[model samples]
Target: MDTALQTKPCRFGDKNTSDIVICLKNREGIPKRFYSHSSVLINKSKYFANRLSHPGSNNCIDIYCSEVNYDHHVNLLRLLDLPTDSILDSFDSVKSAVGILQLAVFFQCEEIACCCIQYLEAVPWEDKEEELILKAVSKLGPKAMPILARIQPVDLAATKDVFISAVRIATSIAGPCPPFGNELKTSAQEQVEFMLGEDEDAPLVTADEEVKSVLRMGLSQIYSSFEKELSSLLLEPDLVSERAEEKILHSLCDLEWMCNILGKMDLMKDFVSNWAESSSNVLGVVENNKLDSFMWGLKIKLIEITAKVLEAVGYGNVILPTPIRLTLLKTWLPYIRKMKPLLDSKGSQETGFPYKMSEDLCQSIEGAMVTLVLALPSNDQADILADWMGAEQVRYPDLSEAFEVWCFRTKSAKRRLVEGLDGAGNATVSL
Candidate 1:
């Protein structure tokens, strides 16, 4: 130890060499001591400099005063005594840092807040939580507004309003407001006039350019485009006005095309798996009930996307083989089955949240899911439909709806009964 210490250099505030204690209170109001040095704390954090300036700031045991809970404050103080080069590398670290940042802002520690702001601008977040962090950072004064231009779509996926606000502030330009309702108002007379007139030379936009613009958009814009299109279709009395969520659906179509073109089905599978996990539920920035929206969870998006992609009759421009198509369908069953209660007539009445998809939406979604099932290769269709109610864990089968879907879509509904799932004759399959 003597030889190694003498041979190598040590950075500032190496561990265990402490002179003062930073005290944080536990839930029971007992003080816990975290080691720190006056020089490092004063130099790195201005709050510590002011707090330690007066001799009375310390208790009899060299414990400097603090009121923030030990859970949130310990890491912030500990970081001060460590080398500055250490980076927070995970999503949870960023989430915790956001909490600690509140403390930093409270104590007038501009330096610590600046570090966190920089970290947040560069990190990938939980998509739904970016607004909370951005809102907090905006209150920190003028120095932090530039981060809006740097916020990626992944950070603003669920909150494009925040992203657009940041862009407007950073660029100092106002864009046109989006009109109400999902569809664009169109005129056939104007289209004819424009097609025949000299305006043809006025920089006509190409399909390639249009698609590039869509691609450049972050997740927020893509989702908005999709959702808007979806609304337009749903609002129309004609159930077939157009495809729903085209931008998202096609952006994914483009991915599927690339995956097939490159022969990377395994990679696509892995990507969807990760996408499914991160987007499993619509979690809010600080909500504790993480899976509160299970019926309309992130998995719903996957299911809808799969239904869009699996249709051999659509203008997808890419044809996924039956097996590949089946993989996408199977991936979403576990998630959709979780919504079985909400799908059942008795269970649907029991739902608490009002925003649950309407009866029309439920029917539309079920119709699409059933269509995708029936579109499966003749041999795979029955198995695919049956798997929705069957999983490793034993739960009450909601084949009630699944059976209803089969009855609606197939001629063999009476012959192919959803029986023997629970090994009891009490398990009935009536459509």
Candidate 2:
């Protein structure tokens, strides 16, 4: 072994310089080691030797180390006085790059981790690289969030199978081995929450101009897919109705996912707002039947998702476009108007109404109305609601209790919506 390799174990560690030296010497078929100090030695020795060594020399080191061995890599980088960014640039594969990022995070090397994450963001999400990508993300854990954010514009629909595969892989990465093992399940949940939240745990990496360009392009592609899907569903109401409720549910679920992604970008707000408008238009076309039920369900989802977007925008300090308010009110007005008869119709003996039918109908309508009202920009809508309340109270004086119940319901809804919208409004105003 060379004198540099033979030096006292202090630099590497006290216990086993021989094993370290042996690992470095043979450099063949090393099955992924995670020794903290070994990463330093391997990185340092390679750097000095690489600088002085011949360009075509076959004397290069090949060490197997987990991505989590980044702390050691950082120490090595420091010892050899190498720019961490330059060291990251040496990685020729996503796996290697991710491994270095994992180490950078593990060793508290923020700048290097940021750089590696930026690099990962530049590469497209390929089907063939799913496993490698998952492994790298798993090792980096929460620190990988920034990279995940950067890849938001990738064509998930084109890579739907791969994307689903990645989700499964991410679940596995966050696992407890036995399906829903406690540790893994908890980790996975935390990861989902972190990625979904505006206040993410990971720091945002400074992306290059090309990465930014690709992200914008990718996001536009995603929006196109969304537009295409929405258009298909709208044009073929029969097709939507023909599909099983579960299938429709699946599409809605995917929309929810898209909403989350759009929520992050700040660009998708208009798309989502437009979706709400289009959803309202379809509600009119839908006649009373199973199709109506599906449309109602979809409308409910839109309402919920719109609220979430508003909340997110408020947090991001992004001022919502004015049209959102008008679009939201227009979308919801028809549903509110439709609820009136449903609330008034009394059960009869010939064509029996279901038990609690009136009450349940009233509640559903009230809930939907409240959600709609809250989503509005709260200018003079209180008078509109008050007028509706007074008219209902007089029309159903015999059912004064129901009227009071409706009023209470409206009040509760108003409070909740106000609180949510107010918070969001404050955020927007501040921003």
Candidate 3:
């Protein structure tokens, strides 16, 4: 560890009062020399004891360090003289403690290492500091297990339990949410999203069949509540109950949130199926009612959800029977086409709460509708394209792609049929 250096004199103990000079050397510039007591060094650090045990004429120890770790090495040497309880007090933050812990581990100074660990384990860390702590402690092995315990992977059952609890709180929509309940639900919902999210690592919850089943159960309850609200609203379409309207809005919001979760888990098939099956009834409730300004938000929310369902079906992400697919389009397409101009008109007005549609959303809805139309049987495509061609407001959905495809297919149908008939007639002579 010995290296020749242009030394700067610093003393942990008084000059000439100590027999040993500890030289801390960095790769560049002048190395620092700390005047210290042999008694304190040998008793505190095993690394020092082993080095000092071998007799030499000049009692000096050289320790080489990187520029980044030079200050930590100096602080650790100073901390060696402090009492065990007071040693932890020197650590002002997790960053400082982590820097010291690395050298403490290398220097075989268990006391300082223990103090660093203690200080770190007791204090809170910023996100980056936590990553630094993990990197530092992971190199020190089992000796730093106390620090790692807090972040270590827990029992699978325990993790699933916590995830399930969060899901329950997030999706708890029975009667009415209390004033503070929304905040709690929001927090839970955000955490549930985090657990299920994937960025640098895999999602926290494995989302096996059991987890998916739990999610499905929660979604079923939400859908049930939403259906009940819609059914009740339909019973008296003319009568406007603010309370009932609010409940219906909240339920739709819940369904919208569920779409995100279910989509991530690839469990959207059931949700999309349910939405598709109920599209007619859903449209009926909206169509029969006279929509006031207050109802525009509700209508917009329904359309937003329908857009996601449309995208899923459009991309063939969620496969459905042809009839259901046809029904879904038939049920919602007219309403969507009608609502666009109304929403735009309302949005342009100087209202307190304007109902605006974003360009991206409009494009997405248009693209999805086009894809959905193209996915249908040729006759169904022809029917949709015919309707789209004749409609007064055909600019929104713009089913030209489907129309062109139908036209090309329709034009070639006769030639393909005649070719098939000629082949059949030619084969008849041999038979």
Candidate 4:
């Protein structure tokens, strides 16, 4: 019997054994227990195997202890078991610190994760070893959620590229299906939104004189370039004669151009407020019969433009002025209420742009109205208007005094009837 253990030539400690082969052999019937004196050799085999199998494993601390030779593992584990204060003062490298973090997180190490996150947060973005930081974060999982939440938009803006790079590293370490995946997704979206000027309703800078000066200079240059074309468009005789929808569309284009030229200035709030004040003056020029029709569509377009501008500026709660809001309510809503019957009566094919246009106009108007109402001061008039319009009063109960004034201005117009009367002496309305 050949009892002289016919073992395969063991390159047990050889770094050139190709880590994959070591792992495969370890899995192929290695005894679970070995002599204490042989632990050094046994552990080296296991370490080589694990490293080969998980080459991309980023958690250095975990990998170090589980895969290193027995004496090295004991030494590192002893260092990790030191008092928290001492551990803070003495770590050889980020890799070693990260290893400790991995061990802590794997064992539900709350205090360890907390301390690591604090240290990692304080590390300068440029100086910190990104791979080690990401590995620590990946292992922290939901424990990292609060730390992530505390990251300020301003800080993120400064280190955006670095942050994105770290995010990719962390995702790779945590694997494709991470437990805290949604948290990462939310953070990414928020960062993008912030960068695109979606975090606030006002412009990025308000009182910065340098920014304002540059803005004014840019606006003057743009106005100089496009003034002639814009004037020609406005002065064309066909503008007044065109269908109200066409005219309103052109006006919307003009507004967009103005917004662009101003470099979408922070002063947009003031500009829009002033524009709203002047809308009544513009409305005065149209003939009475055409005025209602023109305003009906114009108000809807105005609302759409308001929403677009507000969204662009990042002011989620900015409202159109009361005059514009009233114009929408009095001119557009009643028309839509009347037109709904016509839309129902005619088959979809027979309903031309007038019907389809009116529906789109109403939807945009309603959307703007909701936005405006949300920003108004809480009051009875706002409540009444919201309720009359069949809006949910609880969500937006406030109505500004400006809106009330608008309601007063448009009250007679909304209630007015045409000359001809039915048997009840009320004017026969058309869709």
Which residue runs does candidate 2 get wrong by more than 4 Å?
1-201, 204-248, 266-268, 271-273, 276-279, 285-290, 293-299, 310-318, 321-323, 333-383, 390-431
lDDT of 3: 0.82
- Evaluate model 2: give its TM-score: 0.34
Which consecutive 10 residues in model 2 have the weakest lDDT in total?
18-27
TM-score, cand. 1: 0.33
Off by over 4 Å in 1: 1-16, 59-69, 87-92, 150-431
How big is the positional error of residue 413 in model 4, measured in Å on the Cα after superposition?
Answer: 24
Q: Deviation in angstroms for 91 in model 2?
A: 28
What TM-score, to 2 decimals, does candidate 3 have?
A: 0.82
In candidate 1, what are the lDDT values of residues 257-358, reduced to their tens digit? Answer: 322311211223333332333332222211223324332333244444443333321222344556555665565455555544544543456656333334
lDDT of 4 by residue, 182-216 (tens): 46644543443353353445433332454445434
* Each candidate's clash count: 1, 2, 0, 6
Alpha carbon lDDT of each predicted model: 0.47, 0.48, 0.82, 0.43
Q: Is candidate 1 or candidate 4 better by lDDT?
A: 1
- Model 3: per-residue lDDT, tens digit, 226-246? 988888875654446677578
Candidate with more favorable, higher TM-score: 1 or 4: 1
Clashing pairs in 2: 70-103, 175-184
By TM-score, rank the candidates, best first: 3, 2, 1, 4
